[model samples]
Target: MTAGFFEAPRAAEFALRNVRVPATLAPGAVAPATQDGHLDVDIAIASGRIADIVPAGTIDVARGPDLRRSVVWPTFADVHTHLDKGHIWPRAANPDGTFFGALTTVMADRQANWNAADIEARFDFALRCAYAHGVSAVRTHLDSFSPQAEISWPVFAKLRDRWEGRIALQASSILAMDPFATGEGDRLADLVARHGGQLGCVTRLAGEDHVGVPANFDDYMTRVFELAEARGLDLDLHVDESGDPEARTMIRIARMAAKRKFKGAILMGHCCSLAVQPDEAIEATLAACAEARIDVVSLPMCNMYLQGREGGRTPRWRGVTLLHEMKARGMRVAVAGDNVRDPFYAYGDHDMLETFVQAVRILQLDHPMGDWPQAATTTPADIMKLPATGRIARGNPADLIVMRARSHSELLSRRQSDRVVLRDGMAIDTTLPDYRELDAIVGMK
Candidate 1:
């Protein structure tokens, strides 16, 4: 447990007066202002709404002096994370440092070291780090295979109530697709429906894994889709997350969604296999996903850690999906720091900026500050379809992040971590638990 970017944040002044931001330019914008149509806009937000947004030095009446240099933008959305299994490296260490190791260790730890309070403490701390880092929403995948959902759902309910206007927390079930074919599906669906959660399963379309993937394969997804249709819930699947070239579960899922005309949103994360697939296969899947209106989340952190480790030769792949290609096909793709300080990923603090930074490097988005904002900030939030959390506009809620960097380039180059996160137009304190103390809990000695 190391305190880096994930530590809790101190309080900030409650109000931002006349902070300057780019009117036309924004992070993750499809393109910069056409014909240099840029405006240095001074915005004032209050009561959870943009009170005013006028060109800088153009207010009709006398305004207060502008002093702070910052860029105002939407707070981020970590679309994919493992809250139930996060911050448990000390309690359970993965000696193999592989995907299988992560799966087995997480399963064992959930049975042994995990309970209500311990899970709540770790998950709450992760949320604090995200909030302080200017994240307004996070969608975490809970370990729903066991009865832990009974414990986890209630804990999240309490935390959601506590963090209510400041942060929007979304939950998804993480289990194999088969069990959903039986009574477990019905019970989980009831909990999910009651709590407004999604129906999720880890699907590995082609082959099988003893852990972390579905052995029932594409057939079981029928029950999953039927259950989602029955309950009016969205589907979130960990699809094609392996290094195997033939693991094309995502394509199958997309095709099925189209075949059945699945009602709710379909979000597929990981998709590591797509990168290594044949061009024909890639194109076919992309077309299907685009036609199906599916959203894809690229998890760079854990994939980088767990993929391509079994080879005797140098690791040729980066353990991520095709970002540029997906965008080319008009797929709604995003990036998230998946598992932090868990067996899946040894490092990460749930900081969206950190994830965005790594995404910039991995996806080669440094040029023109490519659509990084759209993917990291707005895309996932819109997927949740929540209010006051999607876009930055006059009528939208004042859920935004004002960064220390003065411009987009400077923001990326300097990475000024100092930020003021406003939830419904007011100040709030941040969260980060001490990793060293956690080591003692996990028996560091």
Candidate 2:
């Protein structure tokens, strides 16, 4: 298959024959008009951006034949993921399916095994999976607690370079409180600057009894904020990941960002405790988050699997943060694959399509006729600050995915398809084989 041009070619005209464009750009928002469902359109790529999209019949091309049955949508922009952790450890069956058990296993693995080579191998695998799945852009969290920035940072830097053409990689340094206290935090910030990585923080770190290190939480967060400002870097925190009712770290962080006018650079991932909070409190906290311009990310697969309670009890599940509510409040919200084949989450196969499916069920998003799958996929792109992606429009990058299915519901319900993927206007699989055969090759079946 021909890969997309890394550097924009000098070509004046390019044509995509018989491709169906999604009905709208940013479907829910007020944007330029675009025909929905199936259509035959000619996508002209000039200087790496789509120059114009004309009706398919407008183009008179001789080199290629008709591709009338294909549908094309924007390539996915994955807002949140943990490339470092996603590749660590094997997936072991957790009998209890509790968050604490998963945490314990991760800690044990860190102590027992896991080195640079292992981490690099896993990271490479995850990136390959993402590209094959049509994720053109991703924000990945890399653990920064280690003093060996000489080691960890380089791996990520190399990975970033390796996938430079196919994907946009944003590296975030995942700093814990204790490590920052020991001077690793400042060092991490420096490394982030040197390597162009983003700043990340874990407001609470695991203690001996599986409790949070309370004494250092506030002080560490202060340093994190300061460092982010000093480095002019984006701040993303894994705040309030615990199912514990008392975990109010995210609320405090939101208040701090607001007081300091940090703008919209802050992102809070897996604020799972919000689901268990009182309605009034959740609303108030969400208001503060909106004011702070903080983005929120919900990891349905990991949070749902790790936090839910046992038995058919009254309070059965400790659901993820209220995603739909946050979006309604005008706060940015994104869904992420927090872990894949890692100790924390054994289920993810590096497919955001699967992630979206789980998110729809967890968020209970319902339309009058039915749930809107295209909207679900598009919303997260906006949240992640990925402007070029998530929509099909003239002058936009021609990165798109063509699913075998006919409609959004069919795509979601079936959850597996042989997609004819494209990047930078180049067909990922030029063979254009049957969807069923392609599905088997990708192990989607």
User: Of the candidates shown, which would achieve the greatest TM-score relative to the real structure?
Assistant: 1
Q: How would you encode candidate 2's per-residue C-alpha lDDT over 82-174 as one tens digit per residue?
A: 777664433334545656666677666655444677567667777778877777778887766564456678888888899898878887776
Enumerate clash totals for all models, in the order shown. 5, 2
Per-model TM-score, in order, reads 0.88, 0.82
**For residues 261-370, what per-residue lDDT tens digits would candidate 1 score against the true structure?**
98899998898988888899899989999999999999887888788877455667888899888888887888988999889998899888888878877777655655
In model 1, where is the ten-residue run with the lowest total lDDT? 5-14
Indicate the residue-level lDDT of 243 in model 1: 86
Global Cα lDDT for candidate 1: 0.73
What range of 10 consecutive residues in model 2 has the weakest lDDT sum? 26-35
Which pairs of residues collide in model 2?
23-36, 50-395
